[model samples]
Target chain A: MDVLRPSPSGVVAAEITIAEPMVRLRGVSKVYRSLRRNGTDVEALRPLDLNIARGEFVTIVGPSGCGKSTLLSLIAGLSPYTTGEIDIGGRPVAGPYTDLGIVFQKDLLLSWRTILDNVLIQAEVRGLDRRKAAARAAELLALVGLSGFEQFLPHELSGGMRQRVAICRALLHNPPLLLMDEPFAALDAITRDQLTLDFQRFWQRDRRTVVFITHNLVEAVFLGDRVIVMTPRPGGIAEILDIDLARPRNLAVRDTPDFARYTRRIHDLFIETGIIKAE
Target chain B: MSTRTRNHADAGHPGAIEGKPAGGLDKGEAPPMRRTRRRGAGRGFRRFYSVIATIVVLLIWEGGVRLFAVPALILPAPSVVFATLWERRDLYIAFSVPTTIEIVIGFFVAAVAGILLGILVSFSSFARSTFYPMLISSQLIPKVAIAPVFVIWFGTGLESKVFIAFLIAFFPIMISTMVGLQAIETDMVKLFKSMGASSTTTFIKLRLPAALPNIFAGMKIGMTLAVVGAIVAEFVAADRGLGYYLLYANGQLDSPGVFGAIMLLTVIGVILYYLVEWSQHLFMPSALIRAADLTQATM
Candidate 1:
């Protein structure tokens, strides 16, 4: 329970020390070579500067093709950024850090594995002792409201449940940082709301540092410590809104005037950046 | 894509809804569990009809043969074939029994060899790059064309028959296992990587299990080829086994014997296929259940 409180919008006012940020991206840039143009390089991500502190839930919201996924990948050390050095906990970011967990938009559940076995996959892969981890896995499943569905397969589950399982899988290892790419985007509106709420509760409970990507303004406002709005292609941070929402947020907070203000502020920012079209 | 059961309105299943929404519109309907009992009965009915059709075909053949009265040498009736099977039970027990033994032994040996070879190739990218080409090219060279060479290499005995079967069965197993191994879903691999899984863990948990279906697919094809290979090898050089028995009968103009041996081999192949399916279902109950559910829902 000593897990750091999940700073939904970790305000600079909190006097949080930035000495050893959980993740630091300093002037990071990524460019891709276009084969059609005889391998002429195209810029995808311009220089970026950001420090993600441990236990902070930062959500990146952007229009399509803004390289939000690329940023997450760079943090996970799954890919290399061309121009700048990335550091996690004072160490330089390198290829594929085991301490960083990720969940894709797809459930990515192995059809052959049982639900319980699927959860055990992470433990088996890392050569981690599973007996202890199994208890943690069950606990995480219960936290995600999937307590009795451990025996189910991905196909057997609804879209929302599969996503919940995916979330559970990412946290099964108790990684210091988690990266999610538009996880709730694939679910129905109702399911998405449920999973979003579930994720917020889980984050509050575990306090693992999370970097989630989405285009949904409400999700960004509701879940993140800081909503980092990204511009279009060759993405750059357009605005970083600090949300001062109270703890233990539930459906009750959803109807609050403050929630509408946050949502409206994000919509206005989206219009300014030309990401959201006026109705 | 509308699955079978969900397409009930099209096939005229009972209680079909006329205004049912297109695919993905079944949100309000009960889950598939509630539908399996009814769908299973429909499947059973289809199978029953197929059996009846097969019986009718056999009866028609029996009647035609009786009306034509063709000699057994030219065309043996279904009844005559059955009679041959019953009457020569003693002879078949000796010769055909040995033949079936060789078929089973050769098939199993080939399956193991192919799978092991596939694993070896998959383990080393270099081996897959180098050996896969040769493996595939070897298939282009007709197995029937080189039956004599196989007989020479493995010798004109069970070895030759087994080698041919091994050759025939080898490619499907190798190719399928390779595909299965290569088909390791990127997400599953990434999932493991995020968990700090070692290469060994990735293979055991994701690659190996994922390849089971592909391996089974290869095994099914290998099984059919094994029978073909055994028969081909026996044709070139052999004094026993079904392949030899058929050729010997053909030479002696013992038409009943030829038909009986052919029938026995077909039966064996069918039995082998179902055995593989049954076993796959037993080992992978979840996959089977999903497949069954999919079939029912689609039906």
Candidate 2:
């Protein structure tokens, strides 16, 4: 937390330090230009200044069209920003980098390859040794409770299972930073809960820097070390709340009084920003 | 989570974690063998019906000819056609050799050229814009009208027949492969690029496999058309093919000879088409086939 000291206005305080953050953004903004309509630039995200520490799990929650995904796109180098700079491990992110892994909302599994091969895609792309990578892929898949389903096609697995396979694929190469955009948004309530718990267990096993985006307040608080609350359109960070819940969190943690207070605080912040009308 | 009860969670099945034995390996899960076995049995049953349907159609055709009292000179009965085939099997086989040779050579040449052209056009926007219109316009011209031109240029040998077959077979494969390349999900492409995959690896591992079903689809159409092209070229000018034999028999008013030649040509076409189809199963993953079938069913 020393690397990220917040000012009174809820923005990261400007300070120079010898120790660099895992991720740092300064005056970053994105304006999507519409080719069909001339002279129309849709400002997706306003200038965003933030810093994330290594091994920290930060969950961002925002309303629809509030540019939560745009932030991920900028960091993943899938799209470019209109202004400012983004750095990962002290290197400017000029383009897609090999040191990061991303999980989209859909599983995006290639139906043609077996689940094992799909997980090994990271190694194939990075030109790593196949035998060693294959061994790691098997271990990761087993860690995710997909031990016997290595040869199964994506179509043969259930939706939750497919998403788990996607997770395994994302983590196969053991990237330092993991970017997820509503990865569990498409699942049912039960599956979502199951995955959330399983993900907590997995994340605690070997801490990797994680930035997760979701719309669920409870999910944001339960999984995040700090939940970033974002305002409505032309999205910008409203506040960052540190979750005080104990580690090795499970479904029972959701019922705790501290978890309820964290979710209530985030809910109130959303209401204040008019992201959701207060009932 | 024994393999016996895994079907309940197979693909889009509701409640993926409802009934599971606790302490099952890692989590409650089973291998994919059981689902594959059941699907294999279903496919076998479907093939059985396809064979039965072909036999029933032949039976009906044989019965109809006898019941109508057709004259042998005008309309040869199926039995007479079979007898003619048996009696002069050597002549038919001799004719088949040349036709088979022409088809194999032409089909492969067309396949290689079509695939190369397809890759060139789809990968580069410049090539696509420049050549795509010409590709379409070329297909619009009637292939039959150009068969004579090939004979005049390449001469009335195996060369002309093979060239004609290549001409007929190339378009469908090119067009279908192009469509397949375009049909790949944009997200899938982005995923590969995001992983820092080189262009060559993406094309070979991602784009190629994703496009297999469509490529094979085009190959099936091209195979049938290749048969047509070789026969048409032989009909124009040739002495060793079944097409030539059919024309010669027609001139002599030997109806049974004509029917036998026609049957032989059909068998060749079916065999070629099946060969292409069998490769589809080999090259295409079963998931893609299932998705295609499900899409057809829903549509």
Candidate 3:
């Protein structure tokens, strides 16, 4: 087990055992050229330099059209970057890497497949041991409080429950890195809070490098070890603030003075960057 | 539990004494869950009225024929049509068997070919650009105009009718398969790709299952067209089959025989259509099947 070192901000830090850099982006950038509608070039992401240590939970928060999702896609190797380099564990990302797992905004679970089969998709695609993966799938479903829903289809579950299933699928492969793009944005507040706490508990239990993108600052503060606040067009990092609060965090942690200070700092940055107007 | 039982146990209430105890209804009365006895009876009555309406029209035709003394060669009475159908039942059965075989074989061939081509076109821009336009444009030409050509090419046998049926039914299945395969949510494709899913795995696990409902819809349309194609080919050139028999009856001015053949052809088409519907229920996912059933119920 890696030993936990206190974060530099120093508020009784959780056991954040940062080891070697898991993700490295050296001046990476992306420019999307639209070919279908109008032949126009849109600079979705400016060149960025970011280093995420192994087992770090980083949340990216930005205004809409800030290309926060583009950043994730570039890292996941789902799409090619226009320039610069991205390496995971010192190896350059050439294409979709086997070491990464992704959760999208929607559950994207196959309606025809049962919950168990949907979770097993990762194993099927990766050519993993079917029996072992199925066992893990069951355990993960139980972890996410979805133990009894293995045979149900996607349409049968509520939105929050479906999102939990998607989360289970993302973790079933036990990838070193997990990329989530606003996975809980569509749920109601109560469900969102419940999932957030559940997520925090899981991350605490078994650490993995996570890059979670959200528009909600509260979520960013609640879940991330560091919140990377971003600017609007040609999205670039505006601020990177370390969330110094201790974990395992619950819904009650949000009411603390430290949590408020972190949220306020990000809120102020958003205003200064013209992402939101001060009222 | 005691409070609920006390209400039920009251002896003075006639509601408790009646056999139809719950909701205090009279004996033999319809329950609240039912569709209403009046409405159920009304639907049955409407169906009975439809049959009665058809009989009345037949009676009027029979009466008009006798009263005006219309030529028997020109128009046959209902009785004459029934009598002719009964007398030549063996002939109709014999010819219908071959036509039915042709339609079934043709439809199966079209389904297999259409789905394969659909998968090919969806995966490659080269295939899509090359075949999509040709498939769409083929529909514009009159199928009947090519029926005789099919006879010349494949000869005046089962091959000709099968070829004609396949041609007519092929387009709908092809177009529908293409549409179905492409109808997936973009995120779904991205999801599979991100998981390092191979093209084959993505196709078999994701694209194919998602396309089933749309493919089934197209197949239903193609099935009806297959029946039409077979009959049309039979009309142009066939030694036997219902269409050929109908043409033979017409030549001899056997109006009742013509009607009988036409009625049998209609019956075959109806049976084939219902078969397609039944298969859709069998193959499609339960969620989609339930959705379709709900839509049908509401409509």
Candidate 4:
């Protein structure tokens, strides 16, 4: 386990010793009941327990219909879980958790707003100081190599650029927890690789806790401190493997034996669980 | 007969003009330089074709009328209609003023009332259940059929014409507004909720702006319909306006004057529709890009 470090705002070192996990899920499960289905229920997720320490980068990999997205929504308190306790920063999540950022597969950038204004929506919604948020937005956009594109509308940019703007919006508030659900799934292969690298660099800068959901095995291993492999339908954790990779890893690191080993382990798990067919 | 004409006017007139720029940008991923050049050439060609086609049609009408030696009482040539319009411009202008006022005021009232009622229907289940059905049933009644009733209730003043215009215009606007509000992506709403945004914040920032394109579409339809409604009301009972002028000219067997009045009404309808389209561009410049992207995605 990585040692808990004092927050940059200068908390006493002694307090770090007793720092609680940023997120805690105990026996969390979801069953979707439809009246139109004659009261039949669909179990989306099974009861599961997990802990994510502050500043940890956790990625979840699963097959389609494995409740990967449901888990993310559960953690975000965006949906009601049928059973279990979910705690974020030691507080029980009752409703939509405000002190976090979420990115979905779609960029969801407002069509009418400029890229700068899209990022500023976070501040506008949160009622943050405009000048400070604008400065921060500019910095985040620059970090994503989108400095010159701020005044452009969402459609003027490529799919990859739009997702980058989405990332900037999510990070604008500088939330302690970031939840991403297949954010780069819509991008091309090369753009996806570049964004994965860019995302890792972004994470390194602030080291916020991220629960990234993806179906891509390589991405789970490449970006995560630990990758949680999940079972198909009624999803429960199959395995949680620590990546044990060094910081500031590049795309080149993806070709390394360690990276391959992590990805292979995940791939093997999927095959064993019948999510992948050998035939 | 009036209902048929209104339906034809509402169907696809403004859409053709507004859809051009959007179609140009449909290939969003295409190389910018190549795309812009192609778009410019394509748009220019289309405009050229449109003008040529219109001229050809007019010329054919003029030639056919002269060749057939068609009775002037039966059909006035386009040139004759133009001459009649120019010679009596002051009279046409005087009559058009009242009709324009009726359409404008009625359309303004409809837009305000329609948008507010749409918001109410979308937000409140009670309003939806109670008013939505009535609104739908109201549309089923041919608005032209009720023009006489409006005349009886409001008398033969601007009020009757304005009321008829509002009645015709409000339905499309209200329905479009409702659809726009409800069409918001579920995930987008969830994002707003996760941000701790209040209902008002969500409605104002997300719902309203996202709904603008749709609202503008409704407004375009409504503006044209308002013109129809005012004219129809004048047809029922009015001493002035283009509809009354057409009737008067017909009574005198002045086919040229009648054709001239019809031409002026066409001008008013086209201008009003384009005005709504222009406001949409003013309010939401990215609407075209969004529309283009949608087409591309569907394709």
**Please, what is the whole-model Cα lDDT of each candidate in the order they appear?**
0.76, 0.81, 0.81, 0.83
Give model 2's docking category. acceptable
For this target, which candidate reaches the highest lDDT against the unseen true structure?
4
TM, chain A, every candidate = 0.92, 0.91, 0.92, 0.92
Question: Least lDDT summed over 10 consecutive residues: which range in candidate 4 chain A?
Answer: A8-17
Candidate DockQ scores, in order: 0.28, 0.37, 0.20, 0.31
* lDDT (Cα, 0-100) at A224 in candidate 2: 90
Task: List the candidate numbers ranked by DockQ, top first.
Answer: 2, 4, 1, 3
Tens-place lDDT digits, model 2, residues A1-279: 122222211122122212457899999999988888667788899898989877778899988789999898889887899999999998998877667888889999877777888898788878899999998888988888777667666777777888888998888778889999999999878878888999988887766789999999899999998899999879999998877676778889888889889888888998899988888
Off by over 4 Å in 3: A1-19, A34-40, B1-84, B250-255, B281-283, B292-299
Candidate 4 yields a Cα-based lDDT of 0.83
TM-score of each: 0.86, 0.88, 0.83, 0.88
Each model's fraction of native contacts = 0.42, 0.43, 0.43, 0.39
Worst 10 residues of 3 chain B by lDDT: B1-10
The predicted structure with the larger lDDT, 3 or 4, is 4
lDDT of 1 by residue, B148-257 (tens): 98778878878888777877887888888878888866766766766766787777777877787778878888888888888888899988778888999899998988
Binned by DockQ into CAPRI classes (incorrect, acceptable, medium, high), candidate 4 is acceptable
Write model 1 residue lDDT over A125-240, tens digit each, in one string: 76678898899888877776666556555555677777777887887877788899999898788778777776786777767778999988888888877889898888889888
Query: Which residue segments of model 2 deviate by more than 4 Å?
Result: A1-19, A277-279, B1-48, B281-299
